[model samples]
Structure formats: structure tokens, C-alpha cells
Target: MSSSSSHPDLILTNARITSMSSSPLPSNSDAIAVTHGRVSSIGPTSAIATLAGPSTKRIDARGRSVVPGLVDAHNHGVKACLARLYACSFTFSASPQDIEAALEGFFERNSGVECVMGGRYGSEFFKTYAGQLLPTPREWLDARSRGRAVYLREESGHNGWANSRALELVGITRESVDPKGGRIGRTDAGELTGVLIEDADVQARLRWPDWTAAQYEDAVREYVKVANGFGIVGSTDADANEGILKALSEVDREGGLSLHVVAAQTTPYGHREEPLDYGLHERWRELYTSDHVDASFVKIYLDGVARDDSRTAFLLEQYLPDPRFPESHRSHAHVPAETLARDYVELDRRGFTVKTHCCGDGSVRATLDAIQAAREANPARSEIELLRHEVAHCMLVSASDIPRFRRLNAVAELSPYLWSGESCVSHRRACLGSERVERWYPVKELLDAGTELAAGSDWPAAVASVNPWPGLASLVTRTDTSDPSSAPIGLDQAVSIEDALRIFTVQGARAIKRGKDTGSIEVGKSADFVVLDRDVMEVDPRMVGATKVDVTVFEGRIVYEREGAN
Candidate 1:
């Protein structure tokens, strides 16, 4: 054990370190010394003792796994903030009635509630709503609200459930036509189903309620507090819209935000010309670089998911169950890819970075296309910083496109939480077939191909278990639903525990184009790291995901320390 010295800068001693700069396995006995928010030394515990000074602050690992603080890589900062305002218990809901009752009860107990928020009702739980596959209707919530607007988002965050009054306020009704790449679920007689799914639907609703900057700031503060408690040192925001960016600026001004914010703005469909004035990218940079915010880049969704064909996921060959819809043949190359490729080229030219939401084959193709175009457009810039460009979810990437990802130095942001019940269905079987399904989430293949990858919570957009452990476990075990114990899906495709941890840490930094700044415990790097309760390497792979955070250190600051840790 390294004795505490009179050092005040920052020293972490007696630690089992997992420096992603090296192999994923924990280094036997490493000590990390950080000063001025940068790692000053990382080596044997004995060596670090030499760097200790009278004013240095020391943190003894007490023999725990020490790795870079987990980076979300891809997520929605605003939603993370807003989600805390509504009923949020999702891991417990077993039935639709149970969910409705719980929500209704929450409403009843918390009278004078201003608005109903949150967007995590799984498909299995919503099946019985109104005795059909639909969203929780506005009618259901009308009784609970005394004109208080109740707004609930669907699991995707792309959709939502609003009260009748809320609907009337938005002026949405049965005759509403579906927006491009979005759906408004309807009843048998074509009546408004109250469920909005995808970009278009949400855009339609956005036209209705305009949130105030003060309210949004409050939401962001609440979210940041929760994150700090859970040991999250930073998050790579996927949706940094103008309004949300402004609110963050306010938080930064007040010095209320403590976590590192990698702000990535989304380019809404309707407002396409890339925002000539104060665009998401420009504003984020201006605000982030000024203080607490970290404007790393932007977010663009090329397509939808594997299950939903109506949106944008590229169809590989043909529609699985339905033969009439032509296979998007997206992986090979197409639109968003073509458009994105062009856009990326311009962005790269402008010294901007990016992370695109590419779920299906088509989406991935579009993302890759954008990267290629960007590189070609500016050939002279030689070493175009890969900028940690990421393909959000390579759910069904074509075999041919895998190599391109590596060549471009782009990252694949894997979301194993997709293993949840919502993803397991007859459609998956009928559309992808068991064999195809088995190959999904190709973690090993991408690793073998030499593609840098990162992990993300996609929080508020995904499940309740956003903690990196569940994600780490899911990546290693390839299990979410369908009894992973009996047999894991794509077992061969899964990576080792160490690799998974890296994907969530150092690799995540790379994805956000911040590899040079945070990510590892090396000297000159930010003191952003987490202390685990147990040695993650010695634990069983299955148990890894269930691990807890003992302490989270961000920029030499102890943001979260487990209750037991003194």
C-alpha cells in the first residue's frame, strides 16, 4: 500500500488499473498521478510515490479496478434531464394495466403536476392498452389531469402519448397524415391511436408545446445530479438542439453543471439547410468551448431500426414477412448515405466532427458514404482526424461495409440493451430469420475487422438499466431477453469482459473525438475514471454487468463515492 503523502495535486494509489492504451486486462499494480486536471504519471504504485507533493490530493484505490470514467458515447442530454420529471419505474412493469395503474396512481398522488413526461413503456407492456397494440391514449390520462398537460413519450423517444386536452392543444386528430419516416398508430377505423412513432410524429407534436429555457435548465440540472450520483463523469449527447444547447449554456453560466458534456446536435428533418445562422454545430462549439459544455460534434439519423421498415433502416435484400416492400439494399450504398457522405465532407472541411444514428444496413451505408465523401472532398488535409465518427447502431451492417468502417476509422456504437423484450418478437423471426438474428450485434466481427467501437446508453431512448455494467454484460453475454442462460445469441460475436469495458470507456472517448483528452489513466489525460467495488477482470462475465460503482473521479474531483467508501 502506498502511504498518503503531503501531495494535493491528485494521486490514485494501490490501484488495479485497466488502461485502454494497453491490453484490456487489469495491470497488476499501477498508480496514477494527476495534476491540473491531467494525468501526470501512471506506473507501479511505488513509482507514483515519487511524484507526491505537499499540496497533492491522494485517492487510494484500496485495491479496486480503476479505469477511465465510462463515457455514454451516444445519448440525449435534454431527455436525460426531462425524463426525471415523470413516472420512471420501467423494470417493474409486467402488464399494460399495471403500467397504466402505476402511472395513473403517480398522477393521483402528485397533484398539481404541471406536465406528464418520460418515454419508456416497452412494447410488451403497451400491447394490452385499450385491448390492442397501441399507445396509452390521451383519454386514459384525461381523468387524472385537471387540464394539466400530460405528455408521455413512447419507448423510442421518437414517439409519445398525450392527453386529449394535450392533443386538442396540439390540434392533432384522426385525419392526421403520417409524416415522412414516422407513424401515428391508428385504430381499426383509422382513428388516432394516440401513439406517435419516429421523427415525423415527434416533429408534428413539437409544433405544439414549446418548453421554456428555465424549465429545460431545471431538467438538465436534475439529470446531471442523477448522473453524478451514479458515477457518470460525462455523456456524449446525441440530441443537442438549439433550445437544449441554450439551457446548457445557462447551467454553465451558473456553474451548476459538474459533468463533462460532449454535446452532439441533431439535424432535424424539416430544418435541413444545415442552419445557416447559429446552427447546432456552431452554437454548441461557441457555448461548450466557453465553459462547462463540450461541443464535440453533431448527430444525424440516416434511417430507422431493424424492426420498423416504415422509417429508415436500410433493407438488406427484401422485406422478411412482407414481400411487397422492396429490400432497401442499403448496405451496398444509397440516399442518406449519399447525402451524409456529402454533408460529412463539408463538415470535415469546416473542422467540425460528427456521430450519426445509423441502425440498419442502409443507415450504416449512408454514414459510411458521408465519411468517404468528406475525405475525398478534402484530400489535402491528409490526416483527417477520424473525429471519432460513429455509426450509432450497426444492427445489420452488411459484411462488405465492415471493412469500410475500419478504413475510415469510424466507430460502431453498440447497444446490446436491444436484447430487451421489445426487440424479441415474431417480426424479428419472420423478418430476419433465426440465422440472421444470430449474427446481429456483431461485436467480435467488428473487433476482428479492426474497427474501433464504443458503448452507449442511448438513455431515455432505451431501457432503465442504462448503467454500463448491464450494457457491458450484454455485450459480453449477448443476452437481454429470451433466456440468455440457455443459449446466448451470437455467442461467438461477443467480446471479452476487458474489451467490453474499453468499449464503454477509452473507446467511448475516441467515439466522441476526445481520445486525446480523456479515455485512459495515462499522464496528461483528464483524471476522469471510476473505481469499481470488485476487480472486474476476476469476476464472471455474467456478473460483470451487475457490478456497482464505488466512486467516480472527474477532473480530479470526487463526484460520486459509494456509501461505504470513506
Candidate 2:
């Protein structure tokens, strides 16, 4: 350890420090010194006390546990934050009647709004309404929309439903054809349905009424506060647009956001069929070149989620066909492996990191192949190791591909929020059958193979809130978190509490290639840590989710202090 400077900016005393680096639990250290927003020294309280000076501020942690601040590797920052104030949400248990009631309630309040952007509708909406393949008639949505253009995103964020008015407003008629990597939902008779899938969903989102810069700023301000409260020090905005980047830049200038944010440019949404040329690349540069946003990554969707209206996630085994609507049970890769490999290579060659959404085994395999192709095509690029490009939403991976993640130097980002539960598990069972369902996530299998495992909440897209505690709990328990009486699913895949914590902390940072600076509490690292109400390491595995963050420190400054917290 480096010798501590006599004059430190701050001193934390009487605390249990879990560096999440050298120790699996809180180390024997009782004090730490911070200088210039980075850890200077950590050891016994008496040793650290010698570094304090007249100007140094000292805080007593009251025996609370301090650990590294959590990092979310795969998050939809803008969309998740905006959903808090701007959208209506539904849960997996919601029936057709429930959806109508929720929409009606929204319309009653915003009576004169021209466009409505609602979300959180579950994947089973069409299945429960008319069966699978068939779309709910536009008039059913029009009744609640009150003639206003309405577009509601499915819970998976891979598909959406629009009212007839919205379809007309966006110029989506019978003559409209599906764009590359996108699907326009249509009936067997060739009639335009109100459902939009893949790239089409992205296009519909682009057509929504744009929010003003000020509005974006407000939403982001609240979002940062919420994230701070949860002990999140950094997040990767996996899906970012020009407006989202601009808002972040504004927030940074105003000194509102204390959390570190890395933004990625989203692939093709506004226009159809454009050549991948220098002009397109320059547009990405122009959009995210702000001081606050790291625009060095590209986000691509290789396939849509299997749940909901768009069962487009590419799978090696065919899904069980719905007895009534046999055509509904199928899968397709939104971006073919060859097409994705070409783009992945170009982006990697240009020094851009890549993050793709791959929810199914086929998509995951294809993504791995694409990354390997990129590496082989650019064998001389030594920086490939530094570019830890990841594939998010790896919910299903073929056992044969488990070892490939480490071989390809790719991170396996899992959404623990959907780890194990009746609603989510039942959905998988219905689609993939009982035998395949047993191997849902294979978290332990990946970890045991020396593959880096990263956990993400997937935020507003998930059924639960964006709190990391529940996700961590689910990772270790692999059972129904809401009900204590619920049985465990895939008990063999459950990881230890320490493993779960590492996945949420250091492993997450490694996924984003930011481990050296901020992930752990060590000398020369950023002093981003959180104090908890209780020692989570000592708690019952099931109760870990109940542990609350009492205080959050970012860059040696206390950013969030819970009411009456020590």
C-alpha cells in the first residue's frame, strides 16, 4: 500500500469495509482515508487516524457495512427513466380488461393529448385475447385511446401495439413492407395489423412526439436521484439516441448527475435501408460527442424477445405451437449472423465497442460467432482485449456455447430480475417445455467455466422496479422472491451470496471495461461506495433483498443519505 498523505480530504471511521477486491467479506479494516476523490489508505482505525488534518472531514459509519458502489452493465437508461413519469405500465398478471382500464384511466387524465406512449404491457396480451398469431383488433385499442394516436410498448421492449390512428399517423398502411431486421405484423389475408415488431417498433418509437430538452433534463434529474438511492455509481445506457445524449450533456453541465454514464448509439430506427458508410458513422460521432457522455459503443438488437406478440427470438429448438394458432409458435433472427458479423467487424475496426441484445440460444450463438469473426478479421488489433463488447439478455444459452463466452472474451450479461418466478417461469415453460425450462439461465454453469458473469436489472422493461437488491436476491435464491412459501426453480443454478455480489459489482465493471478505476474499493480507485442498514453478507440469503442502502458515496462525497440514517 502507498503511504498515506498527512492531509487527507476525508476520513471514514468505525466502519466495516467490503472492498470487493481482496476479501469476500468485510475486511478487518475499521477506517479508510480519501484524498482527491480516491481511496488513499485503508487499515486499522488508529493507522488511518494519523492521516487526518485540520481541514479533513471525518464521518463515523456507526458499524455499518461499506462496499463498492453497484454498477449496472446493461440498462436502458433513457427509456427506463422516462417511463417513470411519461408512461402507463402493466404487469404480467394483467388481463385484457385490466389493460383497457389502465388505458382509460390514462386518457381521462391527459384528455387533450395527441399521442400517448404507454408501456409495460405483457407478452401474453395477444395470447390471452384472441390466441397467438392474431392481433387484437385496432378498435379494441381505439376505444381506450379516444381517437388519439396510441403506441404502447410490450414489456419486453421488442414489440409494440398501436391504435389505428397511430398507424395512419405514421403512414403504416397495407402497402408498407417490413424493413430489414424488422417486422410489420400482418394477418394471413395480408391486412396490416396494429402490432409492430423489431425494427418496426424502433421506428414507431422514433415517430413519437419529441420531448423538449427541458423535459428530458427533468426526467434524468429524477432518475439519477433514484439510482443514487439504490447505491448505483455507474450505468451503461445500452440504448441511446441524440436527444437522450443531449439531455445527459445538459445535466452534466448543470451539475445534477453524479453517476458515471456511458452511452451507445442505437442502430437504424428512423430510416429504412441506408448504406453503412462514413456519413452514418459521422452522424453517430456528432450525436454523442458530449463531454459527459462516452459515445464509444454501438447497440444492436439481434432478435426480439420471445414473450409477447413478437416471438422472434431465434432458438435452436422450435417452440411448441399454440394448439389453437399453430403458426404463432416460431422464431426468426432479426439480424442474420452474416449481416451482424459484417457490422460487428466494421464497428470493432473503427474502435467502437459493441453491445447486442440476444435473448435466445440461437441469438446468443450467432452473437458469439459474430464477435469471433470480428476478432479473426482484425487479428492485429491489440486493443480487442480492452474492448469488452457484451451480449445482453442472454436468458437462454445452449450448453455447447457455455465455454465459448470466455473463449471469445465476451461477457454474459444476465437479467436476474427475470431469474425465477411463477409468471416468468411459467411463460418459459409454456414456450420451451419442461425439460428445456429446467436449464433456463444456467448462471452457475457459466461462472464455473471461468466465464465472467454480469447481472443487470433491465429496468422498466422488467416487471419489478430497478432496485439491485431484489436482483441480487433472485440470483442467490432462484425462487419466488415475493412469496416465502414459493419453491425454488433451477436450484442447482443458485450461486452463493458472495458470487452474486461480485457479479453485481466487479464483474459488472469488467463487462463495461471500467474495472480498474471504479468497481472496487482499493487504493488509487474512486471512493464510490455505499453504506447499508445491515451487513448483507451476514443476513439470511432470502432476506438479502430487504437490506436497504443507508448512504451512498460517490467520488468521496456523500450523494445520498437516507432519512435519519447513521
Candidate 3:
């Protein structure tokens, strides 16, 4: 064994380590040595064993597969943790009775919580009860709320539902005018229906009871625990506010953070009538940045979701008109093109990586155009230093705009949680028509065009959890394991497992501007990797979602160990 000073802190022996490096390790390199929170050496078990001192901790993998720790390119980590820990929690498929029961149970269990928040009921809930005279959404919620403020988010996260008490508390009423980029639902009689869309939801949420600083810190800690259990060592918080960033900074400062966090600070969205506060990003960067937290990314929402009933996604082509929206109505952008371009230019000048939410082709094109505008505005910037802005949720991009991503050095951030032939896909199919729906997630095309594709779960929105396994599986299979009988969505767009893995790992690191540090399990990189219960590379692709992490190691330390796993 080597001297204590030269010895590795930890070692893993008899393991199948998939380094995920461009240059593969030698075939005989089955063991790994970690020193001072980074990969120190990689070689055969006999050779690596020689570097371990008397005090070195060693884990016998017993031939299990180990790969780079996963990265969720985009997710609302704090919000997802809050939802998992304290919300009423029900799925979109839950019936009215089921939702009511969930609310009842939540209220019964926690008598002191001032606001009852949860949800994710589908838009079908509104369509099903649109004209009903008795038990309107407000009335239904009112009955269940016990007079407390009740707020439930829609499945898309772009809309919300509130009881009468919540509506009153938020001061949204029949007299309330729709915000420039949002709408308030009302009955034919001009009574509020408790359905808040886009900016309206934002307005209500801004006024709702928010978590305190301590709660935010707790949420961050919980988020890390859940993410580590799922083998996530890095993630981008898609919409971080001051509170979220502060919590992340505090946790990291206290040595509580186990994963790398790239926080995209929130910007104005959906016609709240507020200008983008460019100074806030600079202030946050100075105040909240830590070793594990990067507050240099910004999130901008260009448009809303593409659900059939919402029809809020800004599309180049008009949606198939429904009874509510008759004439030529392709949804409009939240910010004007000129304004978006200006914002992009300023953000680029400030060296912030912008991630714009664009669900429809129109929004996607607008975002790309803005990126081009930024590039034109900054001609002197070198390619190496140019910030790679991302088009988040590039779900319904136009064919002509596909290659522009590579030309402009932009990332197509795909949320695989929304790629399956699930209820949301069906809703999109109805709103977008057959042709567009068939070409839904153009993953292969984007990759083939040389556009860097990054994967995200978009948890607490379309997905039940932040488990990247299911999303990774969906990227290759284009099918949901939960609904095996459903048809594949964009089957031709399915990429290889190798490509999908890269999207989740290396591409994610690139998106977060940490490609050289931690994405792969190469020597000298952060010793962040997961020991899997099965070899995902060799598993049946359909069964990949079931692949579980036996243990998760972060920065040379074990952060999570599944119970009963050896």
C-alpha cells in the first residue's frame, strides 16, 4: 500500500465502470481510486489496490455497473421537494372524487397550514364541468377547503385553480381584467370560475403564503436527498427566485449540498407587465454564488403550454380551432420579438446563459432569432467564451429552425417526461393536429443536425417524480412503461441508448457549462457516479426505467445507499 499522504481516500474494486469519456479507459481498468473528492486513478483491481492505505474505505461492487452520476438539465428542485414533502399530491388521472379525497385527507392531517396547495388535475376537469350549474370548480373546492385558501396547479404548471377563499385572498374576481398575456376563466354569466391561466396563475402564486427562509433551506436539503437517491449529482433549477437561490447557497455553505446546482433565475413571464430585471441576476450572482451553486443562468418564458384546452403555446400555425377560440388564433408571445431580442442581447452581454421556455414552433423560432440577435450584438466574443443559451422544452420546433440551433451554438433542452404517448401528448395531438403530433420530439433530427441535446425531467409538472431512469428510457423507446399498450410517440425520433445517456450526462454538463469538471467518470474528474442494480447499457431497453441505483457516490463520498443492497 502507498503512504498515507499519497493513498486514495476511497476505492471501488471489481466493478464495471462505464467512464463515459471520449477516450475509453483500458479494458483491464476495472477498479477506481478517489483522492480528495476527485478520481485519482483508474486501473485493474490489483493495481488500484496498491494505492489504498490502511484507513482507505473500499467498496466491493461485486461486478455491478457504475456510470457517471446523472444530471437533470432542468428541474424545479426546491418546488418539487416542497410538493413531495408538504402538498396534497394527486395525479392528472385522478378523478374529482380522488382529488377531493386527497384534499380532505391533507387538510385533516395538517390543521394549521393556512393554504391547501397541490394538484395537477388535467384540463379535461374544466371541459367536463364547463357549463354545469351545480358544484362548479370553485364550489367543489370551496366545499373541500374548510374555508382555507386552496390553490391547485394544473398539469402544465402554466395554469392554476383556486377556491373562492383563495380568489378573494388574491383579489381576483369577475371584475379583474385579464393580464396582457394571461386570462381569467369566467362563466357565461360573467362569474369567476376559479380557473387561472398563465399570468393569472402567476399573480395568484405571488400573493399566496410563501415558505420562510428556514423552510426553503429544509426544502433544499430534502431535494438533495431525493436527487442523490435517484443518482443525480448535478441539476439545473429551471426557475429559481431569490428564495431558492439563497437556500441553495446556505445549504452549500454549510457543507450540506451533495450535488452541483446551476440555478436559472426567474424572469418575468406571461404578461405580468413587468420588465426583465437585469440587475437582479448580477445581484444574485454576487450574493448567493457558492462552490456548488452557479447563479449565472436565467430563465425566460416565451409562451405557455400546448394543451388542447389551454391553446396558449405560441405556434407558427394556427391551432385546430375549438369552440372557445374560433378564428385565426395562434397564441401570442409573452414578450414582443424586439423586446426578447433586446433582453437576449443584454443577457448575453452580461455573460448569463439564458434558458427560454418555448413549447411551440413560433416561440422556438422567436427564441432562436433572439439568440441570433445576441450573437450579432456581440461579435467580439470568442467562440470559447460565448455563452451557450438554451431553448428549453423545444417540443414543437419547425423543421427550418432545427439547424439554427447548431449554427447559433444553442442547446435544445428536451424534457423527456413529456415525450411519451401519455395524456398530455394526446392533448397536444388534439390541439396541434395529426401531422405535427407525429413529429413531436425530434430528438434524433436535432442530434443529427449537430445540435447539442440535453435531457431534463421537468419534474412536478408532467412527471410523478424526478427519476431520470424513466425519462432516459422514454428517450430511446418513445414509449411509457406505465401505459405499455399506448402507441409510441415519434418512434422515428428515438435515439440510441448511448445518445440518450450522453444527453443526460455530458450534454447536461455542457448545458450547465461544467463539461470539463464532472459529467464523465474520467480520471481527475469529480468522483461522482452511481452503482446500478443492473447494467443499463445491456438491459432490455423497454425495462430500462426499472433500473435502480444501488448506491450513489458524490465527490468520493457515499451520499446514498439503497436499503438491503450489497
Candidate with the greatest TM-score versus the true structure? 3
Displacement of residue 207 (Cα, Å) in model 2 is 2.5
TM-score between model 1 and native: 0.86
Each model's TM-score, in the order given?
Answer: 0.86, 0.88, 0.96
lDDT by residue (1-566, candidate 3, tens digit) is 34548789999999998888999898898899999889999999999998888889999899999999999999987997787678888887777788878988998888999887898886576776556524568877888788799999987788898899999999998889998767898878898888888888998998888888988899999999999999999999999989999999999999999999999998866653445788978999889989999999999988888887778889999998788786888998888888889889998999999999998999999999999999999978897898999999988889999999999999999988775436787788888998898787799899999998898888877777889998999888988855667678778999998898889888888888888888899999999999999888999888888889999999999999999997
Please write out the lDDT profile of model 2 over residues 298-397, one tens digit for every residue.
8887776665334567788778777633564557666656777887788887877888888889889989999999888877767435466787878889
lDDT (Cα atoms) of all candidates against the true structure: 0.68, 0.77, 0.88
Off by over 4 Å in 2: 1-6, 23-27, 53-55, 89-112, 126-137, 173-200, 269-292, 323-330, 383-385
lDDT sort, best first:
3, 2, 1
Q: What is the lDDT of residue 566 in candidate 3?
A: 79
**Candidate 3 lDDT trough over 10 residues, lowest sum:** 127-136
Error of 2 at 365 (Å): 1.4
Better of 1 and 2 by lDDT: 2
* Model 1 lDDT tens row, 435-516: 7678887889999999999877777665664566777777888876324453577789988887887787778776666677
Residue 72 in candidate 1, Cα distance off native in Å: 1.3
Report how far off residue 397 is in candidate 3 (Å).
1.6
RMSD per prediction, one decimal? Answer: 4.3, 4.0, 2.1
